[model samples]
Target: MNDTVVPGRGDKGLLRNRVVEVENLTIRFGDFTAVDGVSFSVRKGEIFGFLGANGAGKTTTIRMLCGLLAPTSGVVRVGGLDFDDGGNGIKSIVGYMSQKFTLYDDLTVGENLDFAAGLRKLPAAAAEKRRAELFGMTGFDRPLTAKVSDLPGGIKQELALAAAMLHDPEIVFLDEPTSGVSPAARARFWGLIRRITAVGKTVIVTTHYMDEAEQCGRIALMRAGRIIALGSPDELKDSAFPGPMAEVDFQGSDPAAPIERLRKAPGLLALSPHGMRWHAAFSEGALMDAALSALPVSVRVRKIKPSLEDVFIRLAGGAQ
Candidate 1:
């Protein structure tokens, strides 16, 4: 309520709204199951990440939550109202930025903003004020008359976000908003997201980028239409693999032999190819050293911190 997105319930109990909730939500299309009994809750103002590979049902689940598709079974509640009974109500209170850029390429930025404002039924004067505020927040100063196609990818994304929030919706759903943006632009986009949360609006985003997962307050990792892991970044990493990871780099010979040796080493839980090197996970203490020793003398081994990508790959039923 103070216009800042706090994680979970803080000392102030600020996130009482529980902006989005799903329980055993399942969806199927002609016998192909999409979202399979997924359950999660997002607190007001928090950034909740829905992570999955391509074709992992993220879009299907989002559609159900947005009321664009009715679920085959289970329940969904948004903004304290049941999705079934208050689907339209939910739509009114929520803003969604789809994976594809939804702005009209042929229309000027100002025209698109005007159209969104009209759909939301904002008064002309209020629309002007909102546009000014949005331009100021996004630091986008191109003439509003310029066609959306003329703007850079980052600017287009910024405009889409501004359009989505035109009605000051209680919650925003971003489906891979940074997919095509440059690294610098992605950073800028995240800055905009932080600003939205500063205003107490919850943001639920799905992203395939593991580095982006680190940005969320909590991440739900999905696999084959099921949530295989869920927790804060550190919590998930610690609980999933309680060990120090080592990367073994070797040249002048095929790395397969040493990799296979490490795989069979005691206490080694998983071994994977990290680019040209091999990344091995082993529990802390003597076992890790033993696993390192198992590698051939030609291999150069060094301890490295396990990244969210590594964690995701391990949980997605991949080898190590």
Candidate 2:
């Protein structure tokens, strides 16, 4: 089977091994349109990502995918199951972890697990087995008696993930799973996420962190409730900045004048301030020559590859 990721439209036949397929998906609340004709398909065992700013419809689209909310219009399918059956089949094979904390803070680690398993109607022995298996997979050795309220943010998020996966769903949807956690904790959580994918399960994640989004096999960048760009990380980077790019550091000098000057330079398509420096994308070498000729001698110009943040800023950050 060909494992090509395609826009979820036109072709009626399913893409090879596609676990999730959405076609012209749109959701509206009163007059506000949350998701506007978004279409995408996900491959099996792939780490698919949804990226966007606040209210860009990442969560709203994910909610429709998880069968949490019905779409106002368009076709939706998850794990090869259509919504015609009232999403019962779709819900059975998917796990959803919301961006907000959904676990009961008053409960203990084991209690939370039990509560989640009970919701899925898992038996005592099955829940226990899955718990041990998940803990082993995640290297999570926190005591079952520990209160969730007292646990660290990282630990709590991991526990919540464990609860969501208690039923061993085929597809897992994690909405902003690593938000508001330490870098170390986020790294560790992604490690566990990698392990989950290693076992051949599909993961659909929505995250704000560029580094985390880089881990996705393909990313759908959303803006104004629509997919503005969709491709692999490298593909998106190339599409956003197809020509040579450079990072210009002012060498402790004021960048205000140089920024204004480069804005009018020939061959330069984009010039945006990134951190302490400026990233300039040009159609050719004329911009670099212009920078060297017009800018102060203290300035430093070095060629560099574009990162996912660069693409995000260019494509989804409203204006660069």
Candidate with top TM-score is 2
Candidate 1 residue lDDT tens string, 1-320: 21333345345454566777777889888989988999877888888898888888888888788777888888787787666553787788888999986899999999999999999899999999988988898898889899999999998999999999888888899999999899999999999888888888899999988888898989998887888888888888887779888888897578766666777788887787878877788877589898787667877889888888888878885832
Candidate 1 global lDDT: 0.84
Give the per-residue lDDT of model 2 (tens digit) for 165-259.
99999999999998999999999999888888889899999999999999999999999899999989989998998888898999889888878
Shift in Å, residue 279, candidate 1: 1.1
Best by lDDT: 2
TM-score of 1: 0.92
Clashing pairs in 1: none
Query: Candidate 2: deviation at residue 75, Å?
Result: 1.2
